[model samples]
Target: MKKQFLTLAILSTPLVANADNEAVGTPLTAPPEIAAVFAGSAGTARTAEAYDVSPAELDRAIATFTNGMPGDSAQWAVALKKSFTAFEANHPHTFGAALGAFLFNNYLVYHDLPLDDAADAGMKSVIAQYDRLVREHPEDYAAADKEKYINMIMAGSYAAMVLHGHHQDKSLAGQYAFLKSAAGSALENYFKVPVDRVVLENGQLIAR
Candidate 1:
């Protein structure tokens, strides 16, 4: 009877992960210089060095964002994406891409929070952040390389999402494997630049 119960428990398991836990996989915690770079973007949440924008202003912007959204998961995802796009572009860096990825995953999480194996949500979060980096930072990354990175991550995410919808995949480990390999390739291409070109001997950042 115990053996039969165990088998039933295993078979009854749902999606193994959920969207709320999905993150860009880039440590959100950043150094001050990088924080400054992040603070320069428009739609980004306040970083360590973020400018003193009033909370009232932020609340107003958020209200504007959710006011017209349709009540659906996919639509909420679209709304979040659009919200990220519309935020003030004060920050010069695309670090928020990572945060946006997290939020996007959370949006997915809201729909499938009850599922036990929503690993696709986590995978999409990482992919979203990677896409943000590739889309926003072209100078540090070659256009061809950037395109390659976006394609790889997006493809992985879509594939994972499909598997989740099918309910056939018992584990989503393969998606993460693909992301890591793709990220390594992207890193290699991104670092093919002269160190001096991206940094100054004076300890300043490289400019576009």
Candidate 2:
């Protein structure tokens, strides 16, 4: 009986994973620099020497971002681009911070947020961010690995949209499937072990 129960538990595990993805996905906690970068975007740009925003304002912004569900993907995409751009411009020395911010924001919009708009800009940003990373820093292994993960998320979401009959255009579904397959193949080639799932808690992308 114990062995039979163990088999049932093993069989039930996939269901729980799927449920976790849809309901309460994984939460990504960022480091201090990345969190500061996000806060700077919402509050004020930090100086070369230090972050110089009003503590109250920054705190409030952080609360709103961390507490609220993203309303629109395109809007979040634009905000992310703006924030990352600002971070890079202000703190060129802390290059990795910008990347961290990008990854966090992208995951939020790409997966956790609702897909209300079909405009290409949101998806395009995902591709563009990765492209920029590889173009600017080809030798960085982290950038390459991140690109694979981004592609996987894109492909998986698109495939889900089609598989669950969410698309109005079958042709578009086919296109997304192709993109998904391409991303999957690239990810398999690039990373020995890739991230199998991505989950974000509400307001997880926004940081204080």
Candidate 3:
């Protein structure tokens, strides 16, 4: 059977600044409203049925990712990839929104930023890393991996839009359009593809 790959889900944890100035991880609780989103309760757009992954399972995966973190971005990326791969191997459904929720919470905690700021910065950081990998390390990214990463980033972006719309009382269409434009621009810049080649639909990224 073909396995479905999902995006990276980060666990929300308090990080202490260590001697090396790296964020050391500790368990942190997310706000109830935000946690509800991770539990697949934001709306029809965030339903577990929508992604084919149970909320409990996604929570388990999030915990696994959180507990495994060694701090710092490089190590965090490694941990995120490992967690994502493991979840993909075991689950029949996707968990991109769960991953997005984790990442969104982590950014809020790590940056001490407001929701809007955290979402904006966090999504950009993820897309930027993906862009760098495909542009500067094509030999390492691979085609399959590239597709998975793109899906994950876009799914994550969709989750962010859901959250923004829920909390900020914004229009989902507007949020999606903004995110799509940003992601489309990145794809065009890195792969020389047309901005319309990849599109977000029903909370997932579809590549043409």
Off by over 4 Å in 1: 1-76, 79-90, 93-170, 193-208
lDDT of 2 by residue, 1-208 (tens): 0000000000000001112221111122334532332222222212121223343543344344334434565553344334323433433222222222333333432332333343223333433343344334433322222222222222233233332332445555654444344333322222222423342223221111
lDDT for each candidate structure: 0.30, 0.29, 0.34
- Output candidate 3 Cα RMSD: 17.3
lDDT of 2 at 106: 33
Write the number of the candidate with greater TM-score, choosing between 1 and 3. 3
Query: Weakest 10 consecutive residues, lDDT, candidate 2?
Result: 1-10
Per-residue alpha-carbon lDDT of candidate 1 for residues 1-208, written as tens digits (9 for 90 to 100): 0000000000100111112222112223333533332332233322222223344543444344346544554553443333333332312223333333322333232232222433334433443454454345433222122222122222223322433433455365554344333333222223232222222112111212
| Candidate 3 positional error at 207, Å | 31
In model 3, residue pairs whose N, Cα or C atoms come closer than 3 Å (at least 3 residues apart or on different chains), thus clashing, are 9-99
Angstrom error of the Cα, residue 113, model 1: value is 23
- The model with the greatest lDDT is 3
Clash-forming residue pairs, model 2: 26-199
TM-score of each: 0.23, 0.23, 0.25
